[model samples]
Target chain A: MKSKCSRENKRKLENKLFKASSLTLTLISFFTVIMIFTILLVQSKPLIMKKPLSEFLTVEWAPHLGKYGLATFMASTLFTTAIAMAISIPPCILTAIYLAEFSTPKVKEYAKSMIDLLAGIPSVVYGLWGVIFIVPIVRDRVAPPISEALGFIPVFSAQNNSGYSVIASGMVLAIMVTPIIVSVSYEVITYVPFEYREASLALGSTKWEAVKKVVLREAAPGIAAAVVLGFCRAFGETMAVLMVAGCVAKTPTSIFDPCYPLTALIANNYGEMLSIPEWVAALSVAGLILMLIVLVFNVVARIVVIRTAGE
Target chain B: MDKRKIEEKIFKYLMISSTAAIIGTLALIIGSVIVKGAAEVSVNTFINDDVALFPGEEHGILHAIIGSLYLAINSTVISFLISFPVAIYSVEYMKKKSLSPALTISIETLMGVPSIVFGMFGLFVFVLVLTRGFTLLAGTLTLALLELPLMERGIEEVVRMVPVSLKEASYALGATTFETIKNIVLKQALPGIVTVSLISFGRGIGEAAPVMLTAGFNPFPPASLLEPAASLPLAVYTYLSAPGQQGKAYASAFTLTIIVLIISLISRYVSKRFTRYVSR
Candidate 1:
């Protein structure tokens, strides 16, 4: 009895140790987000001290003249991502509807993997492809035609004939975010109970009608979450966008204008401008802004997804 | 009714064509890589590390390939250590807690943090004080952090798949939670855990932004963890910028693509096999 009790005690002690270690590790992982925010805040303190936060949000961005306005980069990031989202969302949803409703099981399986393969391709390769393929196509084929036809519209005018432009970055980002949005929307559509579709079909609606009315309606929240996730993805994408975004520090007035994004700004200059203290702080501030926006979108999306799954 | 029928038919075709368009885009990207990169690939491309300076000269990405593998393996190992434990803690200890949702939200948020921000983190934290500069160690740490949320979420998902009944049976047989977790949960989730590790490893290898910031680019191979290193993605970026070196860039991108493809394919195959075994 004594030996057995001691053995039980040993096991208990070991279990306690295991639990403690795992809990410590979990806390460490949890603290990482906090740590990242804190570090960025600390690093940006110098810039925040030199100038008010409002100063950085203005339009001018000549850092050599002590001007560090980030409005141009911010505007470029938003416009590029907006263009990407606008272009990608419709086709992505339609593709998801196809995968979820139209395809045979075997075909769905193959298509699913194909989409997965597309997602698995690295951003840098996408960047390379954008440079080699998409850039020229945009410069020569797409932009000139549109610019000539709609030169009256300020947003359609071609400011430069350079291959590197906002539209090029937007197109690359659209391609990059397609797999993500499609896959997530596909899963969400599939999760809409089949009985709901059956009920809709029983009312004499066609398959497309059932999907458009019942399935998509049921999955709207989850689909919204997926779009938000895709937005986060395209917004924070650095290298691919950097490669095609022209890296110019000017506010773009047209889709064919070369524009710089926040990610590109930080990436293109972080290495070379490390010796300048204020510039480093400005870069840190850039990262902080990126983190905040991504975090908000991510959290909102997660909550929506969790709520939808619960339902 | 006739108009509605016509509309349905049109929409069906639209959906089909849209999907086909997506597939065509994928095909175009992959086809371009293969066509442009295939002719440049040679034995020397994987064996030699020198860059060709003059016309008709040959060079290989031997160093960049090795450096990428080195960083990827080390980062995956580091992330696995933290992620696996946290995954267990989340599923085993925190699942019933009210704070579970918060933890899940945190992890998901972390997942969405940009890879470039991670690079910035590495640059500021590890490069400034820990390693004193851009080193393989700093890059590894950055990549590890970048991958941790993904790995933990993946492992947690698989752990949640372990049937409650089996765990209850273990407990009825007088097993402690730890014993049940070790002998049953881990056993059941091992394949999935391995799959997640491979996926995250593949992802780590492909990320260039974070690694570019943390791991200073070296033309030659790294001699130690403390020194700067080259990576396949960086190689693609650098070689693409050099005049007359587009072929090498394509080759490097092709090689990186192949590595990512192989890893994900293996994981998929293994997971499918594991599921089949479980069904049997």
Candidate 2:
């Protein structure tokens, strides 16, 4: 009776301990989410209520006047991110399709390893390379000719002091986000059943035809979601854009001309956004804008993911 | 033999180029940094400080290196301490299926959060009037905050990969649920959790934003955790951007990159070994 009672007591104590630790972890995870959203909202409130919401729609960012017009920055952020998506998606999808449908096991293994190492490369190193190589090349050679071709626009009509242009930033972002997009798209394509591939081959359709008709069509939503994610990452990115985007606060009418992005603005100024409440107000305002951008992306991404859950 | 073969050849060539592009970029960055930055490595380079306020004298990134490692290790450990328990609770205890999805969403949102936004939160809450000095401790705490979400995500992923069948089998053997998880679930998930931690470790070591504000880039070695000190990332940025120290900055960047690469690689290796051992 004594031994049986002791064993029961041990079981009860163990149960209680396990339950308690599990509860603690679950709470911590929930708390982290609440914390992230709460912080963004709280920090951004100053600009939301006090400042004109339309101020962000303007072309200038004049802090002294309390007008942190994010028109230029928003444009650059969206434009470059859009450009990257455009540049990368076609090739990435093509690569994904080929790998998913056509490539042999040995080749697939080679690509898989390459993709893994690609994801592992850090952003700062990319930033260093960008400044050392990309800026000079764009500024000296590329922009002038592009401007001459599209001479009607006033923005790129005159030569600028630097050529850390919008196109260059876009190019760099495309390169950075390629692996992430390709890998996800590949995963989704391959997840399309072997039956589809076999049916296509048996139907006298070539492998390319099968992938284009069945696999690619099936995985289109997932690919869109992948592109959206890549876009969001490119938009949120700070370090590389900070180094290469020339840190100028101008609006760009031509792709080759540079303008400061929202991320660049926040990164460049936030640490030094001191003394004036207005600067903090502006920080909050920009934060609010960034928050909306991210929220929209997350919602859309969720919708796409849910829509494609089983298909 | 005609158009189709030609198209196939073009497609093959494109795939090859894409693969080369990725492999080439990685090699270029790593190789270039080593070749250029390694040339600037020296004893003084390690010892001297980048005191921009002073004239004609440069200090090595000794203080920053120490500061960074101290903060990164502290923050990583703290984050792991918190996140590992939560991950354990998330997978093992919450076998009640309804609550797990909500937990998963929370984890996903945390990962989606931008680091810049996190910096603002850090500055506003912790750094402002509360922490008077820009110290190593402040940096570590902030880094811990950044690492928390990532660590939880990593651990949770690994824990989930611990099969349900294994859990059932352990219970069938008359082991208590705690014993099953402790011996089987935890053992199985250990590699994955470690992999995630290593990823976070690399990220923390390379972090610049919090350290920019919280650790006020001291040139000399900080006297204690409370004192400000520069880190490798900050030093590289400050040195490279400054007029005369490009070579030193480049070398320091290389050094920091190597440190990050090694930490991540070792953790990954350890995790893999653990996975192999556990499976056996």
Candidate 3:
């Protein structure tokens, strides 16, 4: 009875209970993250040591010749992602600004709801549209015309029936990522002090000019952070990429040439690759790259947010 | 000069046009998918494995529909079982404790963990290790983890919204903490919980990744707990991407999209109805 009732015992009991839950929570999150990274690391351990992990830096991908290189994949992912970001970020920022600083209440509600609805629409459906609509158009008409018009450009040289071209992939990614950027950028744009706009306008600047010169500069970091979220999402996105990215494992000489994304390799073969450990290795390598890219993107966003907060 | 009048007119038109354009595009997407899906949507699809690729073969989506329902139901049940006790303990009894903040942050962290990463986790650990068991049971458990944080967070919110006055009244009436929770808090939180529950179910139904790994897509009704069953999202994914099934894939996508859209729409309606009630 005394043992059960002891103050020391009660304190110990409470401490144990507390420790149990916190530890459980920690383990759960850590377990999930660690599983993703560790599996990648474990799978890539041999490859990491073999080609000095520098092959991803230097060597061109020659698949049939047994060159397990990532230069092509990385370049393809980065180049088109850059194109997509360039396409999306400006329009997304403009939309956010228009929604936040300009729209009336009814307009704001309607815009936000539409954005939400679009965001909720599955990436697979987006893939179908890209496959059924965009790819054929690009292959049949646009690529050859672009090749003729911009024949000197190294990136538009080869035109294949590779359904989802880099441009198509980039376009789909931009659309997929737009809602996220708009939502976040609009949120940050609204968080800007009304005085920033009012002060600039009072100084004889037109409303648009004030928003451009003052409001845009003030919310630059948040907008950049929003773009980074879009980047992170786009980089890690697998399903739509699998369908729409024209999964040729070659590096693109032109934006018209098809290239497999890091995620597509895994999503395309995650189940069937149990037969081929090489594909497993490839997937794990892709996962590692994906995890690193996303981690860096999120970290960049966080740092920007922190720096902006102090400024 | 009527420069200001022109500016006003331009701004009004721009605002109206932009708003209408955004809604119109989204409406088009939603409407097109429904129409496309409804074209192939049949009672046969819901009740049999009859897959109609083109104008010829009439295969139903019975297997996929059952699999979707089973996975969603199992995940929801598992999440509820795991979350409710922890929720009750945390919201009611553990409110005074120091661990609440830590637990709250943990939940937030889980919420931010990406869905694809969850798929990998399920693949490596649940499907591979603990369960060399890559059956529907494994899939359900994997999804249970996915939905647990969501359900707990929403349930906690609903529970917290219950008034302290009611709790005090129950206490004054000689009710215990457990009694107060059972009698007063739960009933009031029902609508919110129910809505959130539907939302979680909808979310789980749409999850293609973790299910992809844990439940290998077997295109038949699951005969046992260990048997693999095909699901709508997975079917849509494979059929759409896999060679020779592109048409059927589109049909599957249309079907899955309709089901998910309807579920979300209904849940959103429930939330609105509950909000109206709570406001009064």
Please tell me which predicted candidate would have the highest DockQ against the true structure.
Answer: 1
Clashing pairs in 1: none
- Badly placed stretches (over 4 Å) of model 2 are A1-11, A148-158, A302-311, B1-5, B51-58, B169-176
Candidate 2 lDDT score at position A55: 66
DockQ values per model: 0.78, 0.45, 0.23
Top model by TM-score, which number?
1
Give lDDT tens digits, candidate 3, residues A5-114: 69656655664564456346444543554455676677666556655667666535543454667767777788678778987776677678778887878878878867
Task: Give TM-scores for every candidate, taking all chains together and pairing residue i with residue i.
Answer: 0.96, 0.91, 0.82
CA RMSD, predictions in order: 2.0, 3.0, 5.1
Across B1-280, the per-residue lDDT of candidate 2 in tens digits comes to: 8676576677777876766666676677678877877887877677665553367555566766777788778889988988887887877777678987787666666666666766666666666645766777777777888788778878877887777888888989887777887788877877777788788878888877656657767777778877777777777667767887687678677877788778756875787577776653
What TM-score does the A-chain of candidate 1 achieve? 0.95
Q: Which ten residues in a row have the lowest lDDT in candidate 2 chain B?
A: B50-59
The number of the candidate with the highest lDDT is 1
**Native-structure RMSD, model 1:** 2.0
Per-candidate Cα lDDT values, in order, are 0.90, 0.74, 0.72
Please provide the root mean square deviation of candidate 3 (C-alpha atoms, Å): 5.1
Output the TM-score of candidate 1: 0.96
Clashing pairs in 3: A155-A254, B45-B61, B50-B59, B50-B60, B51-B59
Which ten contiguous residues of candidate 1 chain A have the minimum total lDDT?
A60-69
Task: Rate residue A16 of model 2 by lDDT.
Answer: 74
In terms of lDDT, the poorest run of 10 residues in model 3 chain B is B105-114
